[model samples]
Target: MRVEDSPLIDFIREEHRFSFGTFYFFDNFIISEINEGELFDWNKASEVIRVGQEFYGEEGQINYISNRIHDYAIKPQDWLRFLYERQLFKTFAVVTYRKTAIYNLVIERFFYKGDIFSFDSLLEAVNFIREQNALEPANDFDKLTQLYNDNSL
Candidate 1:
């Protein structure tokens, strides 16, 4: 499904725009749409993380969904920065139909150790998140925190 037609659109808690992209914060997930040709690096990642922390708290377990509605370049290595900083997401989902983006996702998997998935439509990604969320405990912050502490240090 298109981003505008997403099932979670009505549930967005807050919407924020940045020079590089737009972030739609939901109750337990974020849908990000970066601008075309923008280079997404650690600085951009930090901005998103800060907003997520502010909206969901430092210990909140949230999923991140990248709605690649535009062509963009991302530094896959920046996942290391997030790991080093102890900022983690429950899962990462990407919605893309582009071949280049699919190749990039493969490269990203080498650096990002967490669970990541890709979908051809926004609705598919959203459904995958819902399924994953259902399998997880309602309060999995402690589990995430412990995992971070154990692996990040």
Candidate 2:
């Protein structure tokens, strides 16, 4: 499951876990910035899923793994099925920190969740996503779902 050399990823950082450079959300996007400690189990992911519901409503079921998250700790195939079956995040973000194998697992399984991006700049990713979503005009469930499917981005 090692990510041999990512063409998709831009850079790598051993410090501060991982981070996003920027992301533009055409709809209500659930961006979770994961730290090394958070990736241990389903609890954190589940919590984020709940918040995403509040943020995006029923359609705000997408899950974006923020920064950290060593892929070795979680089984993404099972995780995706779990989320989809339970009607949690329809989409998700998969990221890597220092390990290639862990990253490989995430990328292979969670690609369909959103527009995948990689970054060594964890703060940059957080800032970018935050700023991008800041102007999203509150969480509009109706428009969000339609836009999610329609945009096909």
Cα deviation of 38 in candidate 1 (Å)?
Answer: 0.8
Q: Write the per-residue lDDT of candidate 1 for residues 43-147, one digit (tens) a residue.
A: 988888888888988885778889988888878777787778774778889998788888878888888878679888776676667667663321233443343
lDDT of 2: 0.40
CA lDDT of every candidate: 0.75, 0.40
Among all windows of ten consecutive residues in candidate 2, which has the lowest summed lDDT?
6-15
The clash numbers for all candidates, in the given order, read 0, 11
Angstrom error at residue 8, model 1: 3.5
* Model 2, C-alpha of 150: deviation from truth (Å): 28
TM-score of predicted model 1? Answer: 0.81
Model 2 ranges with Cα > 4 A deviation: 1-44, 61-65, 69-72, 86-95, 100-115, 123-153
- lDDT (Cα, tens digit) per residue for candidate 2, span 31-122: 33433333334554555445445545665345344444342345455556554557553434444456664556555546335445554443
TM-score of each: 0.81, 0.41
